[model samples]
Target: MGLALFELPAVSYEGNLKEITDQLVILVLDDGRTFNFKRSTNTKFFKNSKALKAAELKPGDRVALVAKLDDRAFLVASTVTFVEMTAERSAEIAAGVRRAQETADAASPVRGWDGPQLKRRALDEPGPIPDPRAGQSPSDDPLIAKAQDAALSFSEALPNFLCEERMQRFSRDSRMIGWKPLDTISAEVIYEDGRESYRNLKINDRPTNKKMEELSGSWSTGEFNTTLRNLFHPASAAVFQSAEYSRLLDLPARVYDFEVRQENSHWNIQVDFQKITPGYKGSVWIEPASGRVLRMEMQAVDLPPEFPMDQVETAVDYAFLPIGAAAVLLPVHAENLGCQRGTDYCNRNVIDFRNYRKYVSDSTVKFDP
Candidate 1:
């Protein structure tokens, strides 16, 4: 029999670009698999039918590529195309904008982080409180050291637990009017082996198969301890300033304002399919007596003008609640707010955590509206 040659057919792949190099591109698929596709001189690149230079490629861009096996059995890209928003994605964005308008016309609670009154209070009243550490650097303050220790302990000592999370999503126009009730979302949050995940989701009292992070409109996770860990983690190299004595929820607190540089920031913002990391500044309220973090707030800083979001901020309040047979400190409430760039559209979410219990391997979860 004569020797025969076989050639594999070209395959198509679609994913978000994670890295782009001169010779190859790394893409992370929606299913979390990472693939590397070699680029050759014969490969063509395009966006909206327009030719693009290799240098123009950026990470986080959605791309579709066709690749064929080379003589060496390596997958080599023959054509790369940048994907624009699909009809479904465009419709979702439009619905979010429409909801922002509808919220302006509806009646609901006036509570929002962006309200003028709250803005003024945030900017003015929180002024430096007279304290013994007024003249010292925040790093030298004993209170900060104690708070950092407490945060580290919380991260390490927390046991695996499950909790019910209730989130009320709202939207409002730029007029700073009252917020309107949009929908209520309920999910089972699992903290296992120092990781957090969500399941058993219910939107507006209706069950859904979608993950909490995959939901349309605004949603957030990691309120349990992620932010606290990031803020107080020694490796984050956050800059702190202006330690002040204050009260949070009637408990004596040591307040410190801190900023995390973009190089060291773990805060990731995702809009549609694009992702960006922006530096953030925030305030942490720590109970002086126990060094526990009572509350924490953050606001994104120096966001790219081209980014879709104009402003992003969050505040979380922590409290000690009985979980199983022990009293555990966990997030009791959280507020997340974001506004569209150059538009009146904004989304706000108020989240509450309750019904905490120790997580077991065989525990079954039922959705509770």
Candidate 2:
């Protein structure tokens, strides 16, 4: 029912409050999952069905919190419902929470690439929105057109590649609690066939939280999903349009943001048999000098009423690096944020990509005469 790629289960987290800060709260659920919600002005708090302030919720209270990632990449409480810890039953549930180091697989890098897949719509056709880039340069510039053409065209066959990733998780909102280090882990991501897989490697010699691992993985992919190729691939069924110019890695980049609002769009998420039409919106930056995507950002909006989570936002950056003999633009970093639509909570992540290499085959076949 949850996003398998991000490792987020569709189920809610119910347990006793473990930690509460002015900016965030942590709940250790009956299962090993830890719920982190970022506090915001819009967050609603409830104590025994009576509305109250977030500061009123105490640690150890029996609580049920819905969660999503906030703008700061922190998962703060959105709406909290709790009953004061009456007896020591909270201790009972606390015992079930596993705080041991969670080692995600070190082999596969991505859970699997789901989208950034576009609708293959005809953006060049006349439409309600005039090409925003029309005034940037004369029709002869062809900066935007060529960039669009580059994104639309897949000329090279992409062989499998391997890269090292450093993922760090933080629990505190810098805007409030300053900085709180949560966990850090490293992994190897491999792109084989068409799907991306992740293999957890080193845990930085630090204990890893099972829940954080899932959150981090989800965050990593969510951010990378917005890259030009991933979103505008030939198989996509999404829409895009020219927008204002945007800066990417300090260079002037043309923008072609996109959105998906219809239920029929493949960008909509589904749980079990139900489709959660949480449409996606984001901007793509292309530097026409070489006609390559330099940056991308995506956010999920207009979620269905039944959706358990609220917000989803991701940002990714691409840099040209010498891969084999060519300087290819590839993902170098990404950030993902999610919130529970039930107005419960939020979570965030920052990922670093490095050490990329083309996959090499070691197998050889001998033919008999």
Candidate 3:
């Protein structure tokens, strides 16, 4: 007689009960066997309390358990401890994690390297001023080191970044229409007086066009750092922290409590963030290695009567740019809805931008002009 499916172990298993939604639970055994079992069968065999708690699973927790096979899924079987550690033990583990993070933050050279604090000296002032990378080679500057480290870390975290993209809005939908591609188009900001205020933007470069337009109207180039700060802040604050994508995509750093899952070499991350008062839930998907955000979904919960909308959803697919940085192209696909007259006013908007880049554009005013 052939061995029944339940006789085998699950192919692979990770995540807590809440994370797994199907009726059948899957578990991978130590012997490299795969099986699926019905949740009903396992419910009687295993104590309800024996199930692993999501909070108990840390970054590096491994467990081996027997599994029974159901129709097309594997469920956890008996004879194994559900959690490797208790809540108290997990808390201690978390404390260690916190300390490590703190130590790392303290050691970062940028902590004390305030650009505004650096004093400008005369040409003949001193012997050799301290090179930030003094003890090290050209590769030793902390900034370079940090960038390298960030790149590596970002490579690992890229899979979880979720980007909400919307298509560009055009008059025609069924038929195709072509506008000036971002790369081929050059833009010059012209003032009301018909004089060119700013005319130096190359289509290939990544610079803030909105800011450029504003400055063109009133010849002022603001601080570079401040512009980056403003552009990134809204997205950082909107997304959920505990969402899986947040943890996987480490950029914008605010959303970092994500969990990663790999399937057939393709990784999936679930990132969620909440907005209180008028409750809202947001989630997204990220391509780990490439840091390409694939999709974003959101919903409003327990909305107040005064609120016009009850739910929202968005998804974005980034093209061409394999990594998140300047000079990369981003075409956005978005959908939105607002409540009006006891009905939802749904609108779809698509924006395509390429060679849409951001950079520091500054000019020294000699006052001779």
lDDT of 1 by residue, 268-331 (tens): 7777544566788988878877889888889887665446776889889898877678777889
Candidate 3 lDDT: 0.31
Clashing pairs in 1: none
lDDT of each: 0.77, 0.56, 0.31
- Stretches of model 1 off by over 4 angstroms after superposition: 1-17, 20-129, 364-369
lDDT of 1 at 202: 88
lDDT of 2 by residue, 1-369 (tens): 876555333245577787777676777555323455566677677876789866777777778776655445555556778865644866655444323112221223231223122222234222234454554432244654576567655334345666777776644322334334566666667666545666645565543444323543333453333345546554444566667654556666666667755443345443222234345788776786878777777777654333454456667778877767767677898766655443323455678888877755442222111
Q: Say which candidate scores most in TM-score.
A: 1
Tell me the lDDT of model 1 at 345. 73
TM-score for each candidate, following the candidate numbering: 0.69, 0.51, 0.26
Error of 2 at 6 (Å): 32
Where's the lowest-lDDT run of ten residues in candidate 3?
265-274
What tens-digit string does per-residue lDDT give for candidate 3 at 17-47? Answer: 3222234434432211223434443443223
Candidate order (TM-score): 1, 2, 3
Candidate 2 TM-score, true structure as reference: 0.51
Off by over 4 Å in 3: 1-277, 290-292, 320-332, 357-369
